[model samples]
Target: METPPQRNANMAQIFHRSTNFISRFSLFAGIFLAGLALTGVLGLARSPYFTRQNVTRSQPVQFSHKHHVGDDGIDCRYCHTSVETSATAGIPQTKTCMSCHSVLFNNVGYLEPIRESYRTDASIEWVKVHRLADYVYFNHSIHVSKGVGCSTCHGRVDQMPLMFQANTLLMQWCLDCHRNTEMALRPLDKVYDMAWRPAANQAEIGRQYKAERNIRNTSELSSCSTCHR
Candidate 1:
């Protein structure tokens, strides 16, 4: 048998650029970004967490978060309009589903549960996964106006096949983000799409809100009494 040629350990490099000048530089850049991605994944895994992968799931209706949030590119406000101004991201009524499916599907496949709900005059039982205790007052608008983006806590809904609660929905996790400004937020609306960081410092924006509200400190952010009885 003929002896096999030894493989060069470094030759496995994916980029075939022959110019050493740019090739080495590209190699380092690729490795750096790769390391960053690995670190992010590790951080998510170690931290107390939830994701569309784990949030209250198994919707009997088989609605697609990805379709609405992804292909249609519908803003959260279109359906859960209250998030911008209310405490809860109110669930879309059966009418909302029928409004679209009336002409879209023209079949009962997607609208069956909705039709049944309408016939019975009952709300479709959507299992909410990210539930905070009654005493914990969570307001959607305050977080949005304070520079918190939706994706930070909810994860990437557009990419999820089924919606899962992406955040741990725990008090500690909220506090942890409150303490760390760097990882806290992103472009205001970007939260609905994915985890995006703000181009500018969010602390400055928060300070403006502070002055507007006249609380003057992070202490005003949230207290037990603020949301609780």
Candidate 2:
């Protein structure tokens, strides 16, 4: 029998060409998707919503941290009273500002909101600068007690006329600090000092504090459960 004049060679060649085209197309598609994904990630990282640098929101009163903390030498705990005792750092009430501005700048135009809030017995709606996700459980009291200074996380508020977020407040950033806590640890007395710097023997001091406080290992501190749970 003639058997259809030997068609196997041509059929095999067509099948091979089709598969090659599909493989090439798939490779190109994968590369395109990877590039797009990388660009998106980079854009998000640099966006104002993520970086949060120099991003200030207008509040009921235009309070300047530089004026209050830097020029006036006000302690952070004075306004954020719960920083040392709670997971959330509480916002200052109108009474807190009136404690000083009541007599100092009571008639000033900028102080009108403060005066109004105080008179109305309503809390001043101070805009939050540093905020974390609800899922992330960060305890300011624990961080403060562990010798992490305010500046270690909050940055130099004393120098900021309008407070803005300094750190990214991302999980990776927290993990980095947790992995290397010594770099941020300070004397417990200097927890509120925003301009504190590491002294000559700061590392040794940090080690001593870590031992005294029985800080967990880096692996424990960087665990997902540490923040997520």
Question: Which numbered prediction scores highest in lDDT against the true structure?
Answer: 2
TM-score of 2: 0.83
Clashing pairs in 2: none
- Please give the RMSD to the true structure for each candidate, in Å: 14.4, 4.0
Q: Please provide, for model 1 over 1-229, each residue's C-alpha lDDT reduced to its tens digit, 9 standing for 90 to 100.
A: 9988877955777665666868788999999999999999977865645333364468878788789888888787788878878888788888887788777875767668887887788888988777777878778887776656777777787777787777666666777765554456454445565636554656676555445544424454445565564
Instruction: Return the TM-score for candidate 1, rounded to 2 decimals.
Output: 0.65
Global CA lDDT computed for model 2: 0.84
Residue 222's lDDT within candidate 2 is: 88
List runs of model 1 lying over 4 Å from the truth: 1-56, 181-195, 198-216, 227-229
Query: All candidates' TM-scores?
Result: 0.65, 0.83
lDDT of 1: 0.70
